[model samples]
Target chain A: MLIGRPSDITASEITPATVFRKRRALIKAAGLGTMMAWSGLSLGEEPKTKIQDYSKSSYGQEEKLTSYRDITTYNNFYEFGTGKEQPAENVGQFKTTPWTVSIEGEVLKPRKLGIEELMKLAPLEERIYRMRCVEGWSMVIPWVGIPLSSLVKLAQPTGNAKFVELISAADPATMPGVRAPILDWPYVEALRLDEAMHSLTILAVGLYGEILPAQNGAPVRLVVPWKYGFKGGKSIVRIRFVEKMPQTTWMRAAPREYGFYANVNPTVDHPRWSQASERRIGGNVFSRRTPTLMFNGYADQVAQLYAGMDLRKHF
Target chain B: MAPTSIAWIKRGIFLLALGPLIRLFWLGFTDQLGANPVEFIEHSTGTWALVALLLSLAVTPLRLLFNMGWLVSLRRMLGLFMFFYACLHFLAYLWLDHWFDWAGIGADIIKHPYVLVGFLALILSIPLAVTSTDAMIRKLKRRWKTLHLLAYPVAILGVLHYLWLVKKDISQPLIYALILFILLLIRLYYRLKLRRV
Candidate 1:
């Protein structure tokens, strides 16, 4: 049996050509009107904020993308709620417009950029990346965003900067989950400076060629393909460059179960579940488990980022 | 109560116990099991098993509290339902979740504490399920009661399995834990009062 092979994904084809064409048309016609029509609709019929004019990247172009419906509904955005379906159901009232992200700490240029300014930092690219969750499920999603390196370079971080800490919005007025103390408030995640600047790392503003739904981290969120899904903090409010590794929310919650670098390692088992194999989300119940890959099948591109470090120790 | 009414009540409880399984099949056939159907099936079966097990444990305390001796007759049926759902839960995990990979299943049972506890609870319940028949109960009247004491441990193990399985949100499992605690406390209270008498 070929375990963790790229061919595991090849068995399924990408979303059909006609749907792709319709998506392209939708992207072309996206405007301020679509943004206004984004509220009070069920996830099945939710009008997505269609992203305009993003260049398609070479990453995972041949892979089958998870359906837009599944991607929008099945999420781990704990700010909205912890249940997979709760985020979509509870996100109707969340307001993402007029958003601002403060970029500071150890950077020569400290400034607060509005959501639009962040999107304009560099040309957005649609990169289909395989996302593996710590709960042993995986999905291939086409995310539209600027590379994290572009924004970090723009910030002009000083030599003292060693790590980047990303913080998610946690307003009790808007987010119901924040009322209960799940994992300390304002979900925080961090990455090493090198990892943040890697080409594979991006701040995703949209997915499936649509402006990100509130459930799927609308406006802007980090997307680190090789790491577990939680590494990507959603609906981010602040990006701070720090000299020391920031204590991430999950790490603080359970230091033994979650680690600083949540890289997708099949050999390393989670305390409660196996990390060796993942159920591809879009398939039916009969779909056989697909073996998880080393660095989630991007080993060649990202292996050098942690050459000498022990993944088992870090994970 | 009259025998016919008692029979009707048992029938009602029986159908009520089957509701979750019927709903599962209905959802499965209608293609509404959601994104991760294997997990959905596994979760549904496991939760039903826990619910039935807790209900079975509640029979005695409820009977005493309400002064209704007839509730004792329903205990076996509730217990059998618990076993039935537990079997389905294990089958789903073994077949749907792991696809009959014995090595993987075996390793999971041995490696994770939650899996091990769940497996142990299922294994221990087998004898209670088999000896539930009237003939077996009559043959070993005194021994039968001792053997059925396994239910307490099984309930404890089931709750532990759930408590350990959750990632961070212990809310669901904590509710189960609270229910189990209250039931056990009621039994303890009765035992102490009987000893004093």
Candidate 2:
């Protein structure tokens, strides 16, 4: 379930940011997991995430990365569990060392390739993007990955291929969260053919220059900066090209709340919460509730994708 | 009319009622209030409010079933505490979430049933808390008990508020609902017994 956002932080007497940082350093020295306790103080810990090694990059922006702790600890990976911390606590046991992703469906050449083989398909670059959650919280993340188009182009989609379905690997024993009837097991997400080939879409392998943490979809995950964060399928094991639009987990669970495009449209409010404003992670708890931007501040890059369509009804 | 023994028991109950507030402060001071501090505080206060309401409602049934007449002494404090925390929960919504966007909140009340029910539960509780004073209780006399009967419906609304709030996984709210059902059954059982006589 999507958790509630920052509430009543204005009057809160939380420790001052300077004092809180001193304690965080102490906690870190003591080898304690005080990340959640004072995560707000660490949001600005890594602000110099400007990557200099991009063979092919566009829309580069200077942004502050969420505290590594908050980014890693607060997750929505239900395959590990529903609670935000559950993924960080449980995903450590997940094996990403020997990872493989099979690219199949409506393609000239279908093949199963290891993680190493996939990484070599295109030049890797770092893209810092703003990820808005459907739950009214947002984050700025610097992702190390390559354009997903690099891989899709290699698979060689046939003329019939118009949509793409991504399946995240979920075994009952390994992903015990699936044992419970929370969401359909082996989480699935879809992208329109044009959307899949967009410059903004990529397959992420790491964050903050480090290999992706298990909780943050280690090995490989999809990053569509314009869409809500949930649309980014994590720990992907299968990529299939389909003719018709494919069904996604959140869209199937609550179609009214989630949509196929799942674009970060502030105008289309979610049934449960308004999407107009979002509290950025890592800022002082109260002063950070800023108005959410259309397509999460990426309208200039991707607005032409939906020129004349009604986002509200399709939302 | 209060005996020394009952007075001592009342003090114990009064202090016990302060436990949630004290615990919250301790957690806050120690920096232990998890990732979203405001949400954590909101949930904790809301949960305690519901628990207090259920406990206060249980007083009457326990008095008759176990012949423990002294339980009534604890009822007023428990009920007042429920109102206190309910106010905190609503404040969290207004201040933390909406930032005093009255027009926005008013629209929310119209669109979302959970917000409507929760707002109703909080509003209905105000009069009950104001009238809880011993002076008001004595002055109002027979009219007091009738007005206080509003507690039952208020409890029902609270349970419903919780039921609609969660998007999925209703386990936490289910326990509260079951207890409320049992309390209602006990009241009905007593009414039938009196009618038989």
Candidate 3:
């Protein structure tokens, strides 16, 4: 989704020479600031104090922060491109201002919520959580958004609101990858109502204190921390509360590979790959790969909910 | 050919096969492979496997299309490279992802469609690689050709496995699909022409 710059920046603010000079100075200042900040560090100093709080969380406290542009722009969304920086570079063309999320299915108040209204519902909160991709790399994102359950409640779901389904925006003009039927365009994700109500499920609007960069699901997106990152569908434009389990985009494409319950558990091996361990995002290359926790290390809070069911069978 | 030269050629092939393995160790040691070394390793190995498979498939076409007979010599080496990469890809998944969780792995083999296809492709390629030697080829004769036909299905399954693994994007897999389609069409046209003749 495109985040338009203010008229001053886009239309006219200063002469080209002055603009270039100012940009150069800003960049120089930023570099100097980083050097000064690093020099201040002592061997005994707490790692958290070394970097900005938000950046600290995403780049583990001890890990050195990569280039801001690299960290912000590069993403693993192969739909856009494979390189980490491809999405940020390619997604600028996505039109996000005139966006509307369609609220349909089992909701009592089925209506489209404009982007502005959606933002007004909840004050943004900065949440630092680990984001593990199925591909094996991970990142810690300080997401800024409101609880997803709050939005689900705003729609006033009916008694049968057992599941919540999210669908991504699909426009081949902008998302060239949509031209191919790799997945039913408009990627879909669902969560049981109880899971949706969990505080960890957020309807993210921003990250790193700025409106989320386009590559990182600009405008609005879901952030289900405990589940694999793909389950948190991006570039979202539709929300459907339903009685039965909706056909999730991935599960629909390959049900056997992607399960309805995509909870992070080391024990559950992906058909071709194992789930026993994960690379902690932002860690050093040689950092020991840690064992994946059941429910992404949130089992104490969420495991009881799945008590009676056999995980292997359900998975 | 002299015995010394023949031994040298065989040694060269074996050493060339070690290229991917050495790069993997280097990346793992230096931390240049990204945050998850195992994943980076697995993905790199999988990609090499795909490239090697494509190269192996190209051998026959190259030989037929250009009459480059020497290209035939590289076929076995390319096919072996494909097997090497496939083994590394599987090992990464088994050692790092599964941690020898056989029950989970067994269940996954049965339950996951993409995994089943990928595993099947790997299994099917085994006999083809084993019987790739000239002596084995001569021994098996007509049966060898039938068994080697499995490469076509293996390629299709490899593409399918990739298609399913990707969550949203299909562009990469689509590219592979287009190339494989062209190769298969070429094979089909030649077969039809020969039959008519």
Best by TM-score: 1
Which stretch of 10 consecutive residues in model 3 chain A shows the poorest summed lDDT? A42-51
Give, for candidate 3 chain B, the lowest lDDT window spanning 10 residues. B30-39
Clash list (residue pairs), candidate 3: A74-A84, A74-A85, A75-A84, A138-A281, A276-B97
Q: How does model 3 fare in lDDT?
A: 0.72
State how far residue A268 of model 3 sits from its true place (Å): 3.4
Ranking of all candidate structures by their DockQ, best first: 1, 2, 3
Two-way lDDT contest, 1 vs 2, winner: 1
Fnat across every predicted model, in order: 0.70, 0.14, 0.28
lDDT of 2 by residue, B1-197 (tens): 36888889888878988898898889778756655666667788899899999999999989889888888888998899899889888887788767888888898887778778878888888889999998999999999999988898899999998988776657779899999999889989999999999
Candidate 1 stretches with Cα past 4 Å from truth are: A1-44
Candidate that would win on DockQ: 1
**Steric collisions counted per model:** 0, 1, 5
lDDT of 3 by residue, A162-217 (tens): 99998888788887667667677677889998899897788887765557666778
Clashing pairs in 1: none
lDDT of 2 at A68: 63
**Per-prediction TM-score, please?**
0.93, 0.85, 0.66
Inter-residue clash pairs, candidate 2: A8-B96
